[model samples]
Target chain A: MPEKVEITPESAVRAVLRDILGLDAEQVAGFDADTELFGALPELDSMAVAGLLTELEDRLDIMIEDDEVDGELFETFGNLVAFAETKAEE
Target chain B: MMLRLEEHNIGAILPDLPGTNESMQPQHAMDLDKWASALLSFSEQAENPTHVASFRGGSLVDHKIELPHWRLSPVKGRSLLRTMMRTRIAADKESGLSTSMSDLMETAHRDVLNLAGNLLNPEMIKQLDSAQPFEFSDTRTVRLESEAKEADAIVNGGPFWLRAEPSDDMDLVTAISNDLIDWVNG
Candidate 1:
């Protein structure tokens, strides 16, 4: 049987920021692991958050419950990546 | 006595609004007001509304609804409706209201197209509406074509192109397409 492939949260976050937010390569490249996201990035507004979560669910094939969303998960790039990773593993 | 409805109240009112599937016209403001009032009353009676009804704004204004988070101008009808729709979906999410698959698909379609118009060139956006085959991305090719369907069909059986790659993450692609369309349309 072929080994199951897994999507890393880092790649997912980068892809979502680049693809969904339309952030250019340079802008996305600037997002370090610790870079703050939710409030820090103007592109990641409320609507953008919804779109991101939905996209993440679709790409990672993970279900994110409404209650699972909170500020800490989006506090920084690392935080979001960790959250996605956890969800993907589950 | 004036009544005030907050953003959450507006959220509750949306699902109950008549003709939600149709685009709202400017002339329907009065009808919207009536629907809002009735919805508010029903919500109050249910005692489970997200927002409290209050007397404020003025005597004629029975429901002083406010969506502070939206920051929408009262003058713009289209903007108001859009904001309301967005807010309603968000609120429904919080309230655990199950959205139908068709409704979700429609919302996704609109959002994707809007984003596509934003990120892509006008030529690209226009091309998407045509029957000619073209590349949408490095991985996806699209072409529009017509199809015959039953009158009451829920799915839009054609006139829209299907992405060529079956194994690709279509949702992510659709999300990316939204930015392009949004740029073009805006």
Candidate 2:
């Protein structure tokens, strides 16, 4: 059996991005607070963002209201992680 | 999955539910009960089905007939509908047409709305909003290791279906097939 590791919001965000974008593990691991996401990555289009947000909600057990989503929230990796952290806490 | 099961001297068959995948029926006219009844008839025509193995949305139909069932990563219909709705909203935004989930749902109620490429009618959408896989004594549920939901067993793998593009995960396939084989022989 795989050992149970506590899933942090940041880790969950990274994993969701990797899974939805079909990126390599190393590529996702390379992401940091400064990494640009929405405009930087071609795969992070509107449709992909929808999938990404839903996957994040599923993985983190958080509900992200539609009104809560904005371009600023997806501007950078750090921004997305912060949003997920806040939602997870609520 | 069928090939692996055959290697173990077990026969397997995957029947496409009516109103989808080359079926003559219109998808907009079908709902959960219709799919369930169609699956029942299809299985009845088969020589003999030892057990029913359903994945995701398929689990919603597997409960109509009495049989030992194995579900892998089964999800609530509302979850699937929500993702599709979000995709629809995104697509509309790309086309310069701003739409919200409530707008899409209101349209769905009055007319057949194509959500994420699926043509869903009012009844279909309404049924999906509350559909859940029925639990019974002979049912076995499996989930990916990353999920928080309870499961009879867990396997390590990503949600391949959620990927932007189609991909293969042989390890996941092997793991699920092994579990099904064990359950069949256990």
Candidate 3:
């Protein structure tokens, strides 16, 4: 059997931020697990949420449902990374 | 050979008739209101040479007054005017003209978000950025990948055209239009 490919949440988050949000390399590089998101960032508005999610789904090859969303998931970068890791594993 | 109410701006005259708030109201209501207002205006102009007074429908005197020669035949033959008035009222309710533009746009924004929500991880949604117009560049690429072999090709320079399958969903179009309108208004 082929070896299971590993996907780190850090790489996934970085790719999503750069590709979908058009963030520069420097901006993305500065983000850490403790970084706050959602309401804290002016760029992270309601409209951008859709495009960002779409990018994450495409890049991570994971399915997400509307009912499963909550504020806690996006409270900080660490929360998001954990959520992504969970989806990736499933 | 048939007269349509939609040929005129009924919303201009009868602003309270439900869907007349926005330009997207039902075509039939608009048509009926236009025809009724025009007929009333024509009657007033014929009666008085210089005054050209505005006539608002719903007075006992107004109902008894006869329409000019041109409009008489259609009304007498099939009760077209009565039918049109009823149709316009029904159309108004269906068009949701009473809803404010801001409310409609807000609903559209939510719909776009919901559609995205279904396909994306909730956590990623929190990291979303502000909307931006998609930028297109000169270079384009086509790639093919498979288990054993992978190949990719790129073309650069000069004018380029990209084609995509057109979306038939009107809601999506409305959402995008509302977003652009918000951007412009801001």
Residues B60-159, candidate 2: write the lDDT tens digits. Answer: 9889777899999897887788899999989888889989888888888889989899988898999999999999888988887766467888887888
Q: Which ten-residue region of model 3 chain B has the weakest summed lDDT?
A: B69-78
Q: Which segments of model 2 are wrong by more than 4 Å?
A: A1-6
> Model 1, B55-169: lDDT tens per residue?
1111122233321111100112222223323344555556787443236336544342223112222232232223121111221111111111111111111111121112344
TM-score for chain A, candidates 1 onward in order: 0.85, 0.91, 0.82
Q: Which consecutive 10 residues in model 1 chain A have the weakest lDDT in total? A: A1-10
lDDT tens digits, residue span A1-90, model 3 = 122234466677765555445455578788888888887766664344544554455447675554455678777878888888888889
Best by lDDT: 2
Docking class of 1: incorrect
Higher lDDT: candidate 2 or 3? 2
Docking class of 2: acceptable
DockQ ranking from best to worst?
A: 2, 3, 1
TM-score evaluated only on chain B, model 3: 0.15
- Cα lDDT for residue B170, model 2? 98
